[model samples]
Target: MKRGKKYVEAAKAIDRGTLYDVAEAVSLVKKTAVAKFDETIEAHIRTGCDGRHADQQIRGAVVLPHGTGKKVRILVFAKDAKADEAKAAGADYVGGEELIPKIQNENWFEFDVVVATPDMMGVVGRLGRVLGPKGLMPNPKAGTVTMDVTKAIQDIKAGKIEYRLDKTNIIHVPVGKASFTEEQLTDNFQTLIDAINKARPSAVKGQFLKSVTLTSTMGPGVKINPIKVM
Candidate 1:
């Protein structure tokens, strides 16, 4: 793969062999984001837990102290009072089964997150094939499926993010934007790290967090020292 000039320049700033502390990593990530637009800073965590084993699955949500710089658009599946509540709580799009065709046939996916009421899961189930692959399917564990749509919408709008182990046992989540102050990015990164640490599965053996890397969308990854993270 041919590397871009900006990427090559940014890569020069990071020492691939060195593991940096969280604060240093965050600073480096910001400095290396040479994109014209505000680049998103993301944390890629490689864990020892195997996602294939049900017991080893690691998944949960957390509210970043400084919300992700990107605005989150929420699509809520609810009916009657719950639907009204969701709209009242600031959900971007609120509807019930009617959205199925709009999404399936029209291929509309304007929202960033999907929030569904418990009763609407049956309705949501119909669109699982479409939503699941996009990681837009609302799960109860992520607080996206709940009777309390108000809290769910509020949390998401306020920077609530779900972190789950992918097929490779790596969890990727956006911490903040490169434009954010170093302190703001560090605070969000620490909050997310604490949440992941607390969600450690009991079935995991040694070194739950095998590796952690912080990087901007277009920057070379800045490795975070796992020992310092703990």
Candidate 2:
């Protein structure tokens, strides 16, 4: 595939062999984002742990100091008072039995995040086939499956993000929009890196963070020296 002019220029700006300092990487990534629209800046981290082992899996969430710069639509699965609570907490959509059919028969899916009270898991479970693949399922580990619907809704609305390993043992997360300042991006990046380091599984015998890279939506990646970032 032919690379776009902007991408080619951005690629040329990077030193492919050098692992830049985290702060320097963040700055370079921002400078290389030549998209007309405000592109999102993301961090892609490769870990030493093996994804094939359940005990070695590293998964968690964090509330970035600066929000993701995207609006989040939340669908809450609750009943009666719980449903009302979700709405009170700014959930975009709240429902019970009606939602099941809406999502099942009508193929309803106009939301970004989904939160559910523990009691409603049985109903939410029915949509697993649909929601699971999209990473929209409300899992307890991500704090989306809980009785505290209000807190859960508020937390997610306040820039909370979940990170989990893929089949390659890599975790990709949005740090912030490219429009954010270097300080804001650095804070968010460090916050995420700290969270990942803190969640290190005992099974990871080697360096927990094998590699870290920062990039914008359409820019070439800037590799970060893991030692400097840690």
Candidate 3:
């Protein structure tokens, strides 16, 4: 496979030590180069850390450089003033009384995130049975419930990724693609790490961060030295 000139140029600019650190951070399990191939050359780093907890639990937020390559359908529950405010803010779905039943009937998971105004807590509270189990219920602690409907919608639409600590207390998310330039990936990786470190809960005594690793969908894992980023 022929590497793109841009990729080659990007690769050349990487400092060896920084590359090694990134390789460790991203956990590049396998490195291979095809002599003759039709596809573009790409590499994936797999970290040796389990992110199931991060994926399933770990409630925190991050704004992606490249918005979540998906359209986020927003549902807002507000009344009178805030209701109109949410709609004016460009929420895909907006309502008060009709919100719960609509969520119960339709596939609520279809939406990326749900936001509710302060007054809508009552409506949001009632749907706990339906939304809680799926981890879709908006919580005040997670900043999903706010009086700032405009900010909420804009932030979410801009690529905010939410994670919560589960029973195990681990958080995992895709930082970037193999096709991304090293610099681009590094920036994204740094942003995510910063978000995670700041998410450490006071209740979590001792090792707030047990260990860190970066891996791909299907790749070997590498252990990242947390100090490198600090």
Candidate 4:
């Protein structure tokens, strides 16, 4: 893949061999962010655990302190009062069984996040094969499947993000936008790091966080001292 001019310039400014502190890494990310639009900044963490094991899987959600600078398009699978509650709580779309056919046939997937009431899980379960790979399926562990439709939508709108390990044992999570201040990004970084640290399973014994990289959508990644990130 050929590097874009702007990206090349940005890469030149970073010392690829250096492992910067979280604060300094964040600053470099912002400085190198040359996207015309407000691009999201994310942290990609490589963990020591084996993602192939169920107990070793790193998966959970957290509400960023500064919030991810993006509006989430929410879809709730609920019925009656719960549906009403979801709509009132700022859900962009709410539905029940009718949603099944829509998703099945029309490919009605214009939403970013999907939340479902516990009772609706069976209904939501039918769409698992469709939604799971997309990372849109609501899971209880991620707080996306719950009885409290209102709080679920509210928290999501407030920047609640789910971080799950990929097949490579790496977790990629957006911390904030490049336009956010270093302090705000740092706070989000701290929250995410703490959450990952807490989610660490006791089964394994190596360096929990093998590596951490922070970067904007179009910027070069800045390696952070993984030990210090905690």
The lDDT leader among the candidates is: 1
Please write out the lDDT profile of model 3 over residues 32-78, one tens digit for every residue.
21123222212222222344534323466788676544567888877
Tens digits of lDDT, candidate 2, 55-141: 899888899999898898999999999988888999999997778878888988999999989899999999999998888999888
Candidate 3 is scored at a TM of: 0.68
Q: What TM-score would each prediction reach against the true structure?
A: 0.98, 0.96, 0.68, 0.98
Worst 10 residues of 1 by lDDT: 221-230
Cα error, residue 35 of model 3, in Å, equals 20
State residue 214's C-alpha deviation in candidate 4, in Å: 0.4
User: Where is model 2 poorest over a 10-residue stretch in terms of lDDT?
Assistant: 96-105
Clashes within 3 Å, all models in order: 0, 0, 18, 0
lDDT scores in order: 0.94, 0.91, 0.61, 0.93
What candidate 2 gets wrong by more than 4 Å, as runs, is: none
**Candidate 1 lDDT score relative to the true structure:** 0.94
Write one digit per residue (lDDT tens) for candidate 4, span 128-226.
989999999999999999999888888998989999999899999999998899999999999999999999999858799999999899889999999
Q: Give all candidate RMSDs, comma-separated.
A: 0.8, 1.1, 7.7, 0.9
Q: Which ranges in model 3 have alpha carbons more than 4 Å from their true place?
A: 1-20, 23-58, 106-108, 177-179, 202-205, 218-222
